[model samples]
Target: MKRRVLIGLFGFNLLRQSSAHHQQHCLSFLPNPIKHCTSIRQSLPQGAMPNNVDARTMFSHIIKASKLRIISILMDNPCAEVIVVPVLSDNYAYILVDPDSKESLCVDPAEPRIVLEAAAERNVRLSAAFCTHKHHDHSGGNMELQRLLPGVEVYGSCYESVPGVTKGLSDGEIVKFGNLEIRCVKAACHTVGHMLYYVTNPGNPELQPILFTGDTVFIAGCGRFFEGSADMMVDIMRMLRGYRKDTLVYCGHEYTLRNLEFAKTVDPSDSVMSKLSWTERVLSMNMPTVPSTLEEVCTFVSSPTNSTLRFLISFQEFQYNPFMRAGDLKDAVNATSEVEAMAMLRSMKNRF
Candidate 1:
């Protein structure tokens, strides 16, 4: 048997492969030939494809090098499986796997049945579950997952009462599922007990670190300040912006297009505008635009006026995301303080 995977800008078109001797009657790119991920493929009409799949679908298959990018090169029989299972409109529930041990964990699986079936598809059992926050959509499936997978380790924040958290984790706490070690980072503003999980594989250095940021952050925007003030957001943003430039980011929802669209209104620089166009192409293929590196989104430019505020703008190449430029926006809203700048930006974003 021979196997060949096509690597493109978006990721691999494993379903659209061919051999020199014969065109392997490969699976139709399901919904769209350009890029149709497994999850999105489930929604297509029984045996038919969609309309936008072919017509002007050039950019849809492109994984924008300027924005989010998937790790495909070093993924041959990798340590963990980052199975993205799309659920409930725009939410992404993940099933993480350690192939050697057959050990698996789920992140923010709000819908139990969908996640359980996704796990079944991979023939992996859920040994544990981590909820990024208490949001109903992120942790709603907790109790049921516990019911289905008895003795599963359910971890949540020490600050909130998560649905079925068998153990409560706090800032800096570390936990493991097989060879994957997850570091808990406390997040503020979106929710008091909001948490972000950072996973590291010491066994495989080539495999980049990954972060599960519930609603604390998005591709181009941070979460709305619901439970805290702008001051609190500044702290959270400061911490997240300092993450390793190579770290991969996965947020809760599919808000890349909307966030980038709003970001263009803030900077309108080639970076943001170009990313917006790229994201539009990604969604056109019904493909997900995620797993963006910290380097692509730590897009901030410091303000000369604010000497007290401290923010490390790591990726100067993409100094575009408005929320990342809190200090730089102080002058826009006549804000004398960094917190004031953040508040004004949030207000405008909510209305945008």
Candidate 2:
């Protein structure tokens, strides 16, 4: 039996509106032969909520309000699946599979057994592995998985030493898997040789792009600077901000709640955080709080002043640290440059 999947109508509306708006004002830029796409909508129960009421409803409402266009569909009842396998406390390993072809790829597999079990259960053949960075928790299973699945292609950063890495990927390198094109971008900061993967369905613009951000970025929080500097992180954020607003981001960890807790301190009056807190409560009970849009992450990372205060409050343990006494961050506080602000934040986090 094919289970019906209820897709939020937000993305559809955005795409429709954008296409219409572009057609009117910017016809030349708009590509010819635009494809009209439709998705199966989950029927809303009659009288589910009064249309005029502004009361909070399901998390789907939040998504609807965001008005983001659909980038990709994860499930169509056995057609394809993005299976999230939780391993080693808060780490997440994802399996992207096309059920019809029995072809699959595992991303950031921390534990080989867990990833193997997930593919086995789905009856899919693992053909490739993608590692975002060299972190033990993210690439630890690469070697083992390669051994188990002979000839499995493992791709990782050209700058980093990834175990069992058969092909080293440089920035802007594209790897094709069926209809999906995965682009690797250098996103150093958390690690000196960190890489971020962006997967897109170029043949179908209606499909959403997916970003596999290792520890460089997370929900409501960025990763700690271990090998790179605050400058690198700032650059990474700017680069990420350039991506399509609707791109769905799949980060490496389940740290949304904790990150939001810190965010609350930074902007106590932010309504978005409040709404997100509710959604986190509901979703975290059963699933990982991820697949956040690029726009959503920008919302959290923007406003250097707010972020500075947030970090100060959250990292009070490092308030008296010597690094805090340095005048280097003074320019950052004045917003002289975003790099300085990010540097200050990273420095504080390091001491924390």
Candidate 3:
């Protein structure tokens, strides 16, 4: 009798598995495009997707047909949302999704496996990848991801050697994916040919604009002057000021703690600087320090007065006293000969 009972239970589970598999296959037929730009639904108008979607929708039909019983027994909570994976020790590669149509968009992918695993877990179809800049950490994963998902659109400012660049994006060009319309803004201060993507979904205006600044800007600090000038950065800041104060700014790198510390040394009296100490500590714990605001940029580091040119000691006016104003510093630097500037920078760095 015990043997018979065991056989019956095993047979029951097999039947349940078959039923679940069939249900999942039926869900696939309900319109889930293998790529993001292609809408799965037949009836909806163009471009309707979210920046993120709960994972349940990926396998909802199967869980429903099984009445959530067998799945609950086999897996963790059925209502648990998908986990957004972090990669490269700092970069957050995300799959922006539209569940109704099963369309998806990939943003700044830094690792192929991390993104592939998440998409496989949710059965999400990846559409295109929007690259913010040419920095390797930001664009390196595109080649491998494209191999896994063929014909995926890689959109960004024209890079001479970037792989999978089906569309060469330029400043002010707007690209659409589901409900999101992303405007590519030329924000090239960190690199010679960098751009930022300003993402907004009209359906939810309250969500605010999402600015992918790449290495051009950071939370408390901005990118180092690599291939661009302070004048160019100031111009970019002026253009960025057009966005609302609450726009969410996502930048490349995880350098908030270090940046805030550096900012404090520059502008100690600023209230924004005083308040960001806690922000630094939070980031030090290996958390994301981005999605900051444009208001914070003005308050913290994004103004003409804080121009990187002024920060470059060789370019700054040498002041006899610590309390000397930036104007005085600028004058002093301008007054110095090239030899004097070099000597001053060496001495200051040694002291600094």
Best by TM-score: 1
Candidate 3 is scored at a TM of 0.59
RMSD of 2: 14.7
In candidate 3, which residue pairs clash?
Answer: 36-127, 47-178, 48-178, 48-179, 49-178, 49-179, 317-329, 317-330, 317-332, 317-333
Better of 1 and 3 by TM-score: 1
C-alpha lDDT values of all predictions: 0.66, 0.57, 0.49
How many clashes (backbone atoms < 3 Å, residues ≥3 apart in a chain or on different chains) does model 3 have?
Answer: 10
lDDT of 2 by residue, 1-352 (tens): 2223323222211111123334211000111122222232222223332344221111221222112221221211222345666666688788775423446898997776667765665457788999999989998889888788889899999897988899999989999887677889998878878988887766555545677888877766688888877677767766765787657667788776765564444444344355355446435434355556654221211122222311111111112111222233445345465576666655555454
Task: State in Å the error of residue 201, model 3.
Answer: 1.7
For model 1, the superposed segments whose C-alpha errors exceed 4 Å read 1-79, 296-318
Off by over 4 Å in 2: 1-81, 98-102, 296-335, 350-352
The best-first sequence of candidates by TM-score reads: 1, 2, 3
Report residue 161 deviation for candidate 2 (angstroms). 0.9
Candidate 1 least-lDDT 10 residues: 23-32
User: Which ten-residue region of model 2 has the weakest summed lDDT?
Assistant: 23-32
